[model samples]
Target: MISGLLTGLSLIIAIGAQNAYVLKIGLHKKYVFPVCTICFLGDFLLIWCGVFGIGAIIQKFPIFLDTFRYGGAAFLFVYGLLSLKNFFKSSGSLVAGNTVSLPSLSKVLLTCLGFTFLNPHVYLDTMILLGSIASAYGEPGKYFFSMGACLGSFLWFYSLGYG
Candidate 1:
């Protein structure tokens, strides 16, 4: 459990797309709970699937991986364009208490989903890497490892969201 927790933290502590978006939303204090929940659940599901050896099944489907890779890249490109436009328009800063309009719930949720699922690195870290590590522990230890990973995810997201 301790090793799992440490491993999970080590993997997730780094800043990435998902963490950046979460921190942005959190700083703005909009949909923080739901956004954080989505992140936590997403991590939990991926880590659990990895620990259970689903990564092997996913590896068998190269076409599926390729499709997701291209699709995610396209989405990210568009999102970047929009963000760049917004930046040029002087929409808002990352500072708290800005009066910028909050995005609609559906839009926010969709964006959060995009950030969560569209990042291929999420799968690589949580599913492939973590899963491979957990496999070394066998059945019961794998479960504990997954639980620790999940806990680490929850702590990180909640802290990033609310702190």
Candidate 2:
């Protein structure tokens, strides 16, 4: 369980759409409850899909993963470029407006959801990665590992939302 917790934590800590959105919401403290709920539920669904063998099925499609890798990389690069552009354009020469806004709750929620669901890497990390790791354990170990994954999702999201 401890090992599982560590693995889950490490994965979730990495930059991703959900984490970015959670941090944005935390900074603005707007619609925090719903944002947290959506984030947690999204993680739960991904983790569950991973533990339940759905990940294995996904691995069969080599082309899909290849395509996803290129597309995801491009998206992240563009996002980074946009941030850099904003940073340069500002009079203070720094990026801002990273926080969530009360008026943009719906937009934020929808964007977060879309990013989470649309990104293939999300599945690659949570479902495929976690699934592969969990498969190494025996029955009891697998159960505990799954539990740890679930707990990690809740803990990370709750802390991120409130922090």
| TM values, all candidates | 0.93, 0.77
Give the distance in Å from residue 112's predicted Cα in candidate 2 to where it truly belongs: 0.9
Q: Give me the displacement of residue 141 in model 1, in angstroms.
A: 0.7
lDDT of 2: 0.73
For model 2, name the residue pairs that clash.
none
| Alpha-carbon RMSD, each predicted model | 1.3, 3.3
Q: How good is model 2 by TM-score?
A: 0.77
Model 2 lDDT tens row, 1-163: 7777788888888867668767767776677788888877887788778878885566686766667677766666766787689667765521234432245767777866756665767777778888778878977787688778778878988898787
Model 1: per-residue lDDT, tens digit, 1-163?
8788889999998987788888888888989999999999998998988888787687797776787688888888898898899899995687777777678989988899998888878888898899999999997898898888888999999999888
Clashes of 1: 0
